[model samples]
Target: MRYFIHLAYDGTAYSGWQVQPGVPTVQEALNTALSNVLRQSVRTQGSGRTDAGVHASHQVAHFEADFPPEMTLDLLRYRLNRALPPDVQVFRIHEVDERANARFSAEARTYEYFVRLRPDPFRRDQALYLDRGRPDVGAMNVAASYLVGQFDFTAFSKVKGAETHYICCLYEAGWHETAEGLVFRIRANRFVRGMVRLVVGTLLDVGRGKLTPLEFQQVLHRQQRIAASGAAPAKGLYLSRVEYPAGIVPAADVREPA
Candidate 1:
């Protein structure tokens, strides 16, 4: 049977979500633990591949197992956590349909990038610190509004393979200030590599008076990644949530925001 696992991780130590031959990755760790628990070579798939130093509040993965039939849900979770490194944790697991996919089956993904104006000891790894003067939050919001629709995000993504189109439906994107920091939340049907970081970086330029909201729109229309400023630090980006169809069995729901 197929199983889905809800997970969260501190990406500070991982290369990313996908498994690479020599690099330590979240997927690799999970596979190793699952394989060890099932007493067979178990493989899994993740919802998305986040960049190095990026974190996730809610990430999901799927695996298939048929050997060592004695394994139970509680036992698998316990053994997996004990076998996996401290940086990654699996909170819940349930048997899912064979058709479930961690990536293709997802309906929406939400990400948040945080920027802080003050020193935060508790959030050093989760938020970006800007020592400069205050940013124009109003202007930044106006610029973010222009990105809320189906559009080609080539201007905001690293130039990747052309096999798939760069178009995506951005449901929500905006900036807000809190005592903790400036929170930038973006929800979309899909995302291109480096898309979120680039959007946040360029919007920061708008907040700092370097780019007008109209100019930001022009950048999007240009369809060139180099037209944008730069990608924000990977440390501040988080996969906050992933929404799936109602009947599908949900994972642990740990680390992911509601």
Candidate 2:
């Protein structure tokens, strides 16, 4: 049977999601844990790749397994978590359609970048500390608005390999003040590698008065990576959510495994 695994991980300790020879990764850790519990080899395909040092509050992957009639989803979840490291967790397991894919079936994904204005020892690893001064939040928002519609994100993407297209439909883009600091949340149909970080960095430039909103829009139109600011640090970014069509996961299996 094919199952969807809902998980979260702190990417600080690993080399990102994909497995690499001689290097630790979230996928390798999960594969080992699942294989140990199932007593068979199990491999998972994740929703997307996250760069090193990025965190995920919610992520999904799919794997196939044959189970004896006695096995339960809750039991599987418990065993998987116990076998996995503390930084990675398995929270829910649902029996999905044979054709449902964790990546392609996803309708949208949301990411958030955290920024801390004041020194806080507790959130050092989770948020980016800006010491220059509080950025112009209003200007940042204006810059963010330019990214709300569908556009080719070639200027912001890191071109590692050939891609079919650079188009992405952004549904939401905005920054909001939080008690801890400020948070920038962006939701899109899909994101190319390094897109968010680069966008965030450029917006930060706008907030700092280094780039005007018009220049930011011009960068997008230019379709050149050099025109954008450097990528924001990965530690401040998190894959906050992923949404799928209603039919992808059955209604009865929607809730977290008990």
Candidate 3:
């Protein structure tokens, strides 16, 4: 049967979501734990990859498994969580249609970038420190507004990306003030490689008076990679959510009794 696994991870300790040679990764940890618990070789596929040092609050992966008749989904989740490391967690496991996929079935993805105006020891690994000065939130929002609607985001994507095209539709994009600092949230139909970090980096330019809002819009229209500023630190970003169509999977719950 096909199953969807809802999970999250703190990416500070691992490479990226995908498995790699020698380097530790979230996928490698998950595959190993699943294999150990199932008592059989198991390979799971993720919804998408988050770069090294990036975090995910919600991620989904799908796999096919044949459990012993006595095993329940809740029991399987508990066992899998026990086998996984502390930094990684499995929140829910349930059966899904064989056609549902963690990646292609997703309708939208949202990412957030955090910046701190003052230093805080606890948030050092989770937010970027910008003690220089508070950025111009007004200017940043003006620049970010251009991101809404469809645009060929070639200017913001990695030059060597494997994607066939650079077109993406943005449902929403904006920066807002938070009690601790500022948060940038963007939701899109799809994203290109290094797209979020790069966008955050360049938008900071506008925030810091380096680029005017109009200039920022012009630069995006130019669609040249070098026209943007350097990419932001990976630690400041998070894959906050992945949305799917209704009935894609069962409703969310803490867990079922085994």
Q: Which lDDT values do the candidates have, in the order given?
A: 0.88, 0.90, 0.90
Clashes of 3: 0
- TM-score: model 1 vs. ground truth: 0.94
Tell me how many clashing residue pairs each candidate has.
Answer: 3, 0, 0
lDDT of candidate 2 at residue 84, scale 0 to 100? 95
For candidate 3, write residues 1-258 as lDDT tens digits.
899998989899999999999999999999999988998889999989999999888888999989988789999999989999999999889888999998999998889898999999998988899979988999999899999999999999998989999999999899978899999999999999999999999999998899999999988899999898999999999888888788877766322211
Off by over 4 Å in 1: 67-69, 161-163, 250-258
lDDT of 1 by residue, 4-49 (tens): 8888898988998989999988889989988887889999889989
Candidate 2 least-lDDT 10 residues = 249-258
Rank by TM-score (best first): 3, 2, 1
What TM-score, to 2 decimals, does candidate 2 have?
Answer: 0.95
Where does candidate 2 clash, by residue pair?
none
Worst ten-residue run, lDDT, model 3? 249-258
Could you tell me how far off, in angstroms, the CA of residue 76 lies in candidate 2 after the best superposition? 0.8
Every model's TM-score? 0.94, 0.95, 0.96
Give the winner by lDDT: 1 or 3: 3
What local lDDT score does residue 211 receive in model 3, on the 0 to 100 scale? 96
